[model samples]
Target: MTVEITGIILMFLITVLFAYPLGKYFSKVFKGEKTVTDFMNPVERFFFRVCGIHPDESMNWKQFLKALLTINLLWLVYAFFLLIFQDKLPLNPDGNPGQTPDLAFNTAISFLVNCDLQHYSGESGVTYLTQLFVITFLMFVSAATGITALIAVLNGLREKTTQNLGNFWNIFTKTITRILLPLCIVGAILLVFSGTPSSFDGKDSLTTLQGDNVQVSRGPAAGMIAIKHIGTNGGGWFGANSAHPLENPTYLTNMLEMIMQMIIPLALIFTLGFYLNRRKLARVIFGIMTIGMLCLVIPTIISEIGGNPAIEKMGVSQLTGAMEGKEVRFGPAASGYWSTVTTIISTGSVNSMHDSSMPVSGVMQMLGMMINAFYGGCGVGLLNYLIYIIIAVFISGLMVGRTPEFMGHKVEAREVKIATLVTLLSAFLIKGFTALAAYMVAHHPETGWAVQPANWLNNPSYHGFSEMLYEYTSANANNGSGFEGLGDNNIFWNVTTGFVLLLARFIPIIGPVAIIGLMASKKFIPESPGTLRTDSWTFGVVTLAVIIVINALSFFPALALGPIAEYFSLK
Candidate 1:
């Protein structure tokens, strides 16, 4: 095995160790355990009193679910209205036009739900009010959804111990006030310093790119980009995306952006272990994530190291590595590393164009999207991982000739069914939609929505198929990273992609939240010889097998059609 691949396997083992403590901590916070309370109790009490919240009151799963859905729904409405009313809004630059109805609806749900599916240009059309609304409503809701997921998990933890999770109001207030808002504010400040535009003026700036005095469009870039990452949202303020210097100016800024995108998802795992009082479970999940990351890094390094054939044909000495569509400052190694990591974690921001990558490297990128979109999104990354944990528990139970239990919670038919549903939904949505899109594009050239000819070469190169597979997978998985060669902003793409985003995301979230609620209500079993220690080596192998097999099997046919087909064609 390659070093990167080996690293990935090792990383999984390390992640397993980390996850247990993290999950334990997560459970601890929700249950108001002594360790977490000793530190956060004073803060919680002070804030609850100041904000007039009843910390003692708790809500059931149904109530929690309702509030979570309602908040997101309202935010969606707000995002839609803002997009529709952009021209009339205060933030409009002097000459920009308003959005059409279909476009507005698509964009609203896309942003509010953290879908990142945009059909419109950011620089030319949006006014100040539109940008502000996107920042205020869409970004806020994007971050809010993460908060809601955490609250739901906490509720599950509380139910297991005290029969009451924290109240929705209290949880929401604390999460936003303490965690989301603070991170966003700090992130925004750092982004501004790094040169992401901080202006509301719709006026275009005069800039000489490659020497011509062209007009560079500006908006509330810093404000949006901050929460964009903090919320694990992948939307770019401009078409150039993070590849643009203005959006991602410095090395320091880039690192910060990457770290912030990952922090909450990782932290949530610790929270889970803490609440359950089973550090081992969290470690196993963490191990899986780390292993996934290690897998991501290797192919990326190899691809980058392989360099570009087309570039080589140009008589340029390929000094370092793959150069096409990648930043020289960050280089292929860093770009490849980030690409894999982000896809696995559900943060789809890219520093390089994935479309131009080498075939094998591109395959790994595709794989990450498969893992993320189907698994869970953003803060829900670990939640989806938890589903796999349940599967591991179940399989381990079978091995031991006993019923499987996780953290003393049983893995019954309903729980496994829901978990399975959650895993398969995104795969189905992605592959089915990709096939549909391919057919539509082939049959309807007049739609002007076909894959780019350059991207859809006659050859079956892994790179070519990766670009094709990436489009639907990214949409279906809701990762939002593209090979950058797809025409996804047209009527067909807009509507189809928008539907995939909504259904793929909300439905999967509902599944895990429901499972967590059910598990929380059940009684915890004491550890015994019959109990399968999930943190053990035997369990880890089973966990890895389940995740690897599920993703490989689910995406196999689609992968063959897209990347594999293209690879063979190339040969």
Candidate 2:
């Protein structure tokens, strides 16, 4: 027990220790400063020129978003068609079939948005051709998409007033060439060394000790698995995700994978400070975000480590904690901590089955997605936090009877409205969609739909309600983890959550970038004694309060209907 707790603490400390230096490196990358990866400059220039792009060209926020959306749309159309015809393409040693149209639509958007919510299983549903072209290709770009968009926000925040942030194509190219590509290369090597597969070999027939024959799926998984975590694009090479023995092989790999997922998200906080030259401000933001993580994770760890009381009611000893749906190699403590981290960071990878976690742990996982800002996903996580900060800074200024100024710009109604709408959109999508699905279950469970609503849920009553709620929440947060207790492979979930996934990923991103761009164009205000000290501990408390209140108001009732209700029912 003590050892597992220690290991969890050590994992977090190692990540932060590594993040500090990486943040410094990130600061340099965004500023167009020289770096160790300058060797990639030639490759970047060649790629840009081939694509008819000028790396030196600058763009305003609107133009920047235009380029981002245009490319994403192109990729979506390309991936959808390719997925629908994958079986006819190359790389099908396993003779895997092509995806159905609706599943293809959902899968393409899910990966394209950096939300790798798989409605179809990884190994069987996708050929190695689609896996490499659609899944892996999108993982790289979608993550780069979020991070590069964040660079725009960072550039805007750094300036007192400016119209253009930077060149989108240039930042995008450099982000992939210098940062993401190198990191994935290194991560892929480490994973392969640690027993993850890197081969293109198809299913290998084998006989177990009990003489039963099984065909185990194998492929070029190490490369995708690398960015799957490092980019926090947590789609798996296998259906079991990180829990698969091949994907995450050892205890060392578990720690390594978690650290890789967390590094950029945490480092970006410090990068924000370095980018703005406001180290104190970064510290405050990091402190608040860390506290948010602890609040969610501590309860999860304790509950999971405390074992299941319902199981304790039986004669079976549970001194080893709740081991159901968890890996024996990782143990409950690490799995509980992982459950919280993956959900909060929007990585959405799992080493344990979340549906089998204690109901209290389920609430924490949902809360992580509901809040959706603590450490967040890649470059986008910082963007999510900035929205909360804007709202907090605005409210704090109103209370103090002063103009709200953040980083030398006034907080106005336009910015606040954008932030509020983005915040409310999550509540709307999750609750609104879940309500519709629930209505279908109650009123039309036996409808003539292809996949009946009566069979949608794998559990009954309150726990069943949570399965539905968790799916949409995951989609809305752009966190692709599922309860796995929901039978969501059908058209109903695929199409509905498809729209939710699209709106949720882009809108929150658009809100922050737009806000920062607007603020960057506003007249600069010099610091006054009357000006709020945004970097102080006082502002941290205010931001924390705003996060709590907004999330509670937006999600508390829905939570009560799902995980909260189930927690007590277990009792």
Candidate 3:
């Protein structure tokens, strides 16, 4: 018990220790200040020249978003075609067939949007060519896309009165060349040395102790695994993800993978402080996020380490804790902590099966995604929190009978409306889709659809409802982790989740950037006694309250029907 608790504490301390320095480094990289990766500038310039992008040319919010959307659309098309015809493509040593159209559409959008909510298994479903060119490529760019959006918001926030955010193409290329590429290369080398395979050789046949033959799949997984976690793009090379021995061979690799999943998201929070020269404000935001994250993590760890009460009542000893759906290598403590971190950061990489966890642990996972802003993924974490900040500022201003302002910029009706819409849209998608699935399961069980509700779930009753709710919640949060008990690869899931992924991803990003842009263009107001100090501990409390209240109001009913209900039933 002591060891488990110690491990969890060590993970948090190491993450923060590394993230602070990395945050400073990121500020330097993004601000065009001198740094170690300056040599990569020539490569960055070369890409810009080839792409006909002017590095010096800046854009307003609209132009930046247009470029972002257009490029993503093109990438989606490219990935869709690649998936649909993968068998005919090069590097398909395993001779895997192409994906069906619906699956292809879902997959393309999933990876392209950085959600990586894979309905198909990696080994059997995708060719090596598609894995490298399509999956790996999108992992880099999609993460870069989120970072670029955050950079634009920082540009808006830092400058007192500027219509122009930086160039999208420039930031995108530099983010890859300067940040993600370097880290991935180093991490990949470490993974390779750690015995993760980095070869294109096909399956190796082996005779077991009992003399049965087995064909073991192998691939260039080390590099992909590194980027998948580092980029917070959680599509695994194998369907089992980090739980597979080949994907994560040892305890050392497990620790590294867990750290990689969170480092960037953690760093980006401090990057806000460094970039905006608002260290105090950054500290406040970081504290609030950390508090919220720990609130989820501590309870989850306790529940998981306590094991299942129902099993205990049957005279079974659970001294090793909840080992049912968890990896023995990682154990319950590591798995529980990983679950909270993955969901909180929106990384979605699992070291254990979430489906087999306790109902309370499921509730923690759901709450992590339901809030969806504590340290979050890549650049989107701070951006998501910015929505809460806007709402908090408005509410605080109302309480004091003054005009709302954040960072000296007035929070107007336009900004509030956009933030509110972005906030509500997540609830709308999650609850709406879950309700639809529930209704279909109850009323139209024999519709002959590719996915009948009765056939969709692997577990029935309250647990079954959780599977449905979890799928949509994962999709809506863009977190990519699933309950796994749901049969979600059919046309109905593929298409519906595709649209949900698109809207959930882009709108949250676009809303924050647009609000920042609108605020950036407004005349800077001087801080007065009446103005709320966002950097203070008081504002942090208010922000936390707003997040809790809004999420509670939005998700409590749906949660009551799912994990909450199951939790009580278990009791």
lDDT of each: 0.68, 0.92, 0.91
Ranking by TM-score: 2, 3, 1
Q: How far is candidate 1 from the true structure (C-alpha RMSD, Å)?
A: 4.6
TM-score of each: 0.86, 0.99, 0.99
> Candidate 3: misplaced stretches above 4 Å?
none
The digit string of per-residue lDDT tens for model 1 on 1-571 reads 2543444344434544543454454444445555533555577678888977776666776777787788778877777777777777665666677777777777777776665755665665466677666644566666567656766765565444444545776666555555566678888998887778887666565657577676767777887787777777777777766777888886557666766676667767666666555567566666666667677667677767767766767798877677778876666666676677667767677878777666666677778877772223556676666677787787777777898787667779999998888888878887777766565546653544344433343333444445556877777666777776665555666677778778877776777777777877788777787777877767777777888899989987777766556545544
Q: Top lDDT: which candidate number?
A: 2
Runs in model 1 lying further than 4 Å from the true structure:
1-55, 158-163, 205-211, 373-376, 446-468, 565-571
- Clash pairs, candidate 2, are none
Model 2's number of clashes is: 0
Q: Across residues 1-571, which tens digit of lDDT does each residue of candidate 3 receive?
A: 8987787778778888999999999999888899988888788778888888899798999999999999999999999999999999889888899999999999999998888899999879998899899999999999999999999999999988999999998889888888898889988998899889999997788999999999888899988898898888888998898888889888888888988889999899889999999999999999999999989998898899999888888898898898987888888999999998999888888889999888889989999998999999889888899999999999998999889999999999999999999999999999999889889998998988866767999888888999989988888888899998789999989999999999999999999999999999999998888778999999999999999999999998888888788888878
RMSD (Cα, Å) of candidate 3? 1.0
Candidate 1 vs candidate 2: the lDDT winner is 2
